[model samples]
Target: MAHASGMHSLEFKLPDLGEGLTEAEIVRWLVEVGDLVTIDQPVVEVETAKAMVEVPCPYGGVVTARFGEEGTELPVGAPLITVAVGEKQPTAGTGDTGTEGSGNVLVGYGTSEAPARRRRVRRERPVSGASATAGQTGAAGAANGRADAAAAPVDARAAGAAAAVDGQAGGPATEDGPVPVISPLVRRLARQNGLDLRELTGSGPDGLILRADVEDALRTAGRGATAAPAAEAHPRVPQTPGPALAAPGSTTAAPAEVRTPLKGIRGAVADKLARSRREIPDATCWVDADATELMRARTAMNAAGGPKISLLALLARICTAALARFPELNSTVDAEAREVVRFGQVHLGFAAQTDRGLVVPVVRDAHARDAESLTAEFARLTEAGRTGTLTPGDLTGGTFTLNNYGVFGVDGSTPIINHPEAAMLGVGRIVPKPWVHEGELAVRKVVQLSLTFDHRVCDGGVAGGFLRYVADCVEQPAVLLRTL
Candidate 1:
C-alpha cells in the first residue's frame, strides 16, 4: 500500500454521526495540510441539522490533503481528509489491513472492532481492469491493497457503463471488488426504489456514489426520464419562467429582493413544523388560570434559600404530575404500525430559543427528578443551547414537549406540536389582571395555558382533563402536593 514516495496514503471519510443525519456543513477546519495529527484528535468542526460537532480523525499521520473547505456541505461518507502514515494501518475495525485505528470516531460511532458479518452476493465474473481501477480510486481502495490508487484518474462515462452492467448482472461485477458504495442505507434506498446504481456517475471523491447522487437520479426519473441514458442526456429540468424582462426603454426598475436559504437549525425547525401540520390531526385547547399561588410558592421556595428554583422548573414539575394523572397525554401515535406507543419513562423536552434558532433539549427521565434536579438539568441544557454545544442526543427522543413562549413577552400562543410527539403544553406569560377571587373582585396573577395534541391519540375528554389538572395545579399549587 506504500507509494513511491514511501508514505502510505489513507483516506478518512466523514463518519456517520447517528440519529439518521445525512449531511453536515463544514464550519471550520482544525488542521491544515502537512500538519501532524494523532489518532482521535479533532481535525474539523461541522454543523449538522441537529447540532454542532467536532469530528476527530481516527488515523494519526501527516495531513496530506483536506477535502471540503469551510462553509462547504458534504454527505455522510464523503472524503474528509487524506493522511500519509509512516506504516500501513489496518482499515479501522475491518481488520483488512495491518494498522489499528483509534476506535472512537464520534459520540455514538466507533471503529474498535469489526462489525457483525453480513452475507455478500458473490460476483460471477472478474471485474474488468478499467472498472476495478476506477473502484480502487475511492475510500474502499484504501482497504484493498489500493491505498494509492486514488492518485489515478477515473473515466466517468466508462465507470457509469460498468455500474450499469453490474446492475444488470444481478450482483457485484467482480468478486469483492469495488462497487463504489460505502453506506448500506444508500444501497437499500437504491434497491427499494428500483434505481440502477451503476447508471449514474457519483459526485463524491474518486467517483464514490453518495446518497445525494441516488436522490438526484430519482428526482430526474420522476420528471419522466425512464432510462439512465435518458437521465444523463437531459439532466436539466425546465424551471418556471421568472418575472418578465423590463421593457427595453422603460425607466421603471424591478423591485429589489433579498432571499435567505432555510437551512441548518432554521431549516430543521421548518421541516418538523410542516410535517406536524401535514401529518398530525392536531387540535388546540386553551384556558385562563390564576397563577398567583404558583408565583407565591416559587417566591417562598426562593426565600428558604436552597438553589433558587426556576419558574420553568416549577412548571415542568406541574407538567410531570399532570402527565402522571393523565398518562394518555404522554404517548405517540405510530401510523405505520396502527398503534399508540406509550413510553414507560418520561423524556421531557422544553423549547429554548437561542441565537441560532429554537431548539428543544430533552431532560431524560424528567418524571423521576425532583424540582431541584429538574432546575439544574434545565439550566444545563439551556446554557448548552445558548452556546450551541448541544449534541444530537440532547435534541431528540422526547415523548412530550413543554413550550414556554412566555419568555418572548407574549401573553399567549397556540404552539405547533413537535412532530412525532403526541402533545405539547404551551405556557404564556403571567401578568396581573382583574379576577374574582373567593367571591371578591381583586387583582391576581393570571396566565393562559394551551395544549395542542394529536386527535388520533385521545379525544377531547382526555385532553381537557389533562389541561384542567394543569390549570388546577397552577391556581392552587397544593394540588401538586399529592403527587410529590
Candidate 2:
C-alpha cells in the first residue's frame, strides 16, 4: 500500500537480517537521490555477515535522500533512504507534502501497514542509569548508526509524540490496528516466547516491531528475575584498573599480525563454523573409493552425448542414492526442540571457491535432477559464485554438502560441517594406484572419500554404512542403477 497518497515522505531503514546480525556494509547503490523507483525496486546492495543481498524498498517514489557511502557500515534500524511517497519530484523544496506510501512492506525489508490500529509500546532514547543498561542493544545501534546525509521530511508527528505505529496521522487512529511488522519471523519469535506483540516497543523504522525488540524484552524480564550481586548493587569503586594483566614483575609484548574485520562473506563463514563446532558433537570418518568405473562411465556418456556430463554431477547422483538408503545423514539436529530435522527433498550444497571467499551454493531438489540437469545447474551456480552475485537465498538452506577437494589436488581432509546441516561428504584427489581387481593386480583410479557428521544425529555405524554405499556406487556405476 502506498503511503497516504498525498505529499508525504517515508523513511526507509536497514532491516535486521536475522541470526543476531546488527549491521551491513553497503557494497553499491542502485538508485540516485532523484531516481524514480517503483514498489519493490532494489535501491542498494549490502553485504551482511552471510551473503550479498540486494535490499528492495517497499515504498515507491522519488529518492529524496541517500544515506552512507559505498564502504560505510550502517546498523539495523538506521536510515538508508527517504522516499517521498506518491510524488514525482519527491525531494524537499517541491513544496509538496508527500505522504501516503503503499501500505505493502516486503518481508525482506521492514514495516507493513495493517488496519488494526494497535499502538506500539513507547520507546525513548536511552539515558544514564538503569534505562541505559536496559538499552544496551539500542545503544550499540546508535553508536554504529552512520548516515552521510540528512533525510527528507515527512509527517513530523509520525516520528514524535503523535507518531502512531502505522506512520499515519498524529494520534492513534484506531485502538484495534495490528502492530506494524513485515517479517513473519518476528511474529513467530514473539509467539514462541509467549510475549505479547501489543505491548512491546519496536526499535524499527516507523515503529515497526522487530525480533530484536522482542528479544530485548525477554532479556529485561530475565534480569528482573535475578537478584543483583552485592558488589554491583551498591559499592565503592576505584576509577583505575586493578592491573591484573601486567602484574608487578610481568613483561608483555605485542604480537605482529594483519587484522581483518569480521564482516561480509568471510564473517558469515566464520560464524557458521563456530556455531557448528559449538552445538554439534561432530565426528569424521573416511574411506578410499575406487573411481575407475565411474570415471569410465562418465567418459563414455560424454563421448556419445551432445552435452558433456561433469564428474561432480556423477558423484552427486551417487550421493543422493546413498542418502536415500541412509536418511539419517541428511538431517539436522534441532537442539531447542530436542529432535532431528529430516527433509524429504535433497538440497545439496557444493563448496566453490570464489573471489569473495569460499561459498557453498545449494542445489535445490538434487534428488529430482538427473546428471545432465545437475551439471547444468552446477555450471550456472559456479559462474554466479565467481561473479559475486549469489544471493542470500542461494547460499543457504541445504540438507547436506558435497566438498570436491579433488580439484584442489588434496587426498583427504576432515572438512568442517556446515552449521544446521547434519553432514558433509568430501571427495579427494583421484589418481592411478595399484589395486587388486577381480583377483588380479591392476592400476585403478582411487579417490579418498570423507564423511563428517553430527554424532547427535546418528552413530558411527550409520555414517560408515553411508560412505560404503557411495564407494560401492563409484566402483560399480551399475550398483547405483538399482536405486535409479
Candidate 3:
C-alpha cells in the first residue's frame, strides 16, 4: 500500500503551523536525500517565532529530493520534499520510516494536529515520595532509607546551617558531638564553589556552616590555587552578553560599556539582518507624502466598526495593492539558483514590537484580503504578539515585510531587507508640517516613506516607483476602496 496519494511522488511543502505564519528558517537537516524515513518521524529542525522545532515526515518512504538549503527562508506552500509514494514502508521501531524526506512549504507555522504516530510510550515506574519505601525502589533503596532515618535527629541543625550558608541566618555554635551536620543549601553552595564541606568550620545555629564559613572557604581556596575540592566542583552555566560595537556618529572612541544578551527573537533578527547586509546589494529611495486624507479615511473606517486601524494598516493595504500591480517587487531573487522566483500569494509580514523582541507575523493572502480583513488580521497578529501568544505559524511565511518605525516618532529609517524576499518598506512618523499646495503655504499632515530593496533583484527605479505608489494610495485612500 502507498502513503497519502497513490502517485510515486508526494510533495511535502511547508505547512502553516499556526498564528498566520508565512515563512521559516531551516535550522538543520536531520535526514538527507536517499535516506529512508518513517511516517511521523522527525526529519528536520526549523526555527520559528519562539523556539527551534523539529518537523516530521508525514509519510513513510525513501527521500527522492530535498528542497531549500539550510538557513534559507522559504515561502509557505513551496514544495520542500518528495517521497517515493509506492515504496514499501518499513515496520515501526525499525527507524526505517522515511523521516529522511525533503522539506516542504506551507502557510502556517504549526501542525494542525499531532501526528498519528510519534513515539512509543515509556513504562518507567513512578517515584514514591517517602524514603521508607526506598528498599523497594532499587539497590540504593536500603542505603537511602538508612541515611534518611539517621539524619532525622540532625535535620533541624542541617536546615539551620543551610539557611546560614544562604545568608539568611548568622550565629556561632559550640560543637555538641563529633558527627558533622550540614544543610542541603550549604552543601549545594559549597559544591558550586568547589569547596570541601569537611574542612569548613560552622558558625551557624547548632554549629553549622554559615555564609561566612562558605566565604572563608572560597577565599582560602582561591589563595591556594589548588584543584577544586571534590565536594564543590559542580559545573555552572551562566548567561552573558555578546560582542559590542561603538555607537554611531560618536566623536569619542569609547566603546559601548553596556551590552544586551542576544537570544530568542532578537538573536534571530540580528543574524538575519547581518546576513542580508553582507549578502544583498541594497538601494534605497525616499519620498514625502501628505497623509491628511489617510487620517480621514482611518476615522471613517473606525466609525464603521472596522477595528481601530492605524496608519501602518493603511500603508500595508497600499503595499499589497502595489505588489499586485508591480509583481516584480513582490518576487524573490534566488542567487544560488540563478533565477527570480515570483510568488502567487502575498504573505505579508509586519514588524510588530513586543516586550520580548520584534516579531514579524504574516498575513497570508494579503492581496486577496479586503481592507477590513487585513485590519482584523493585523489586529489579531499584533495582539497575539504583545501578549507573547504568537505560535510558530504566525511568525513564518512572508512574501513582503513592513516595518513601521514611525509609530515611535521617527521620521524615516532604512530597514534591512528580509532575505529571500527582495524588499522591505519602512513607514515613518506622521506630523503636521507646512506644505505649499498649488500656490499657497498651508499646514498638512505629512509622512516620510522609505523603501529598501535588494538591488540584485530590484533596481532603484523599481524601488522609487513602489514608494511613489504607496504615497499615492496614502494621499488618495479612495484608491484602496477601488481595489476592494
User: What's the distance in Å from true for residue 306, model 2?
Assistant: 3.7
Q: Lowest summed lDDT over 10 consecutive residues: which window, candidate 2?
A: 224-233
- Which digits, one per residue and each the tens of the lDDT, describe model 3 over residues 1-484? 1122322556576676555446666645555544445556666665554544566776655454566655455666666666554433443444343323223332222244443332111111333456324423431232232221222212222233223222233443222222243323344456545677778779876776755577677765543212211112122223343345535542223233323435446677888789988888888889999889899988887888735776566777899888887788888877788888889889999888764567788999888876678888999988777644566767777989988888898998988888767888888888999988668999999999888887777677777778888889988888776677
User: Mind sharing the TM-score for model 1?
Assistant: 0.68
Candidate 1, residue 121: Cα displacement in angstroms equals 46
Model 2 residue 259 CA deviation in Å: 1.4
Model 2: lDDT equals 0.70
- Per-residue CA lDDT of model 2 for 1-484, tens digit only, reads 1133344566788876775668888766666654445556667777776566677776655554577876568899888987654433222223344344544443245333322212232332324565444444442343343434322122221133222222333323223234665343355456545678889878877888865687788676652212111111122232243446666554333223223455577778888889888888889999887899899999999999689999999999999999999999999888888989899999999999864568999999999999999999999998777655676677888999999998998899998999899999999999999989999999999999999999998999999999999999999999987987
Better-scoring candidate (TM-score), 1 or 2: 1
Question: How do all models score by TM-score?
Answer: 0.68, 0.64, 0.52
Of the candidates numbered 2 and 3, which has the greater lDDT value?
A: 2
Off by over 4 Å in 3: 1-260
Residue 237 error for model 2, in Å? 36
Which sections of candidate 1 miss by over 4 Å? 1-6, 88-99, 107-255
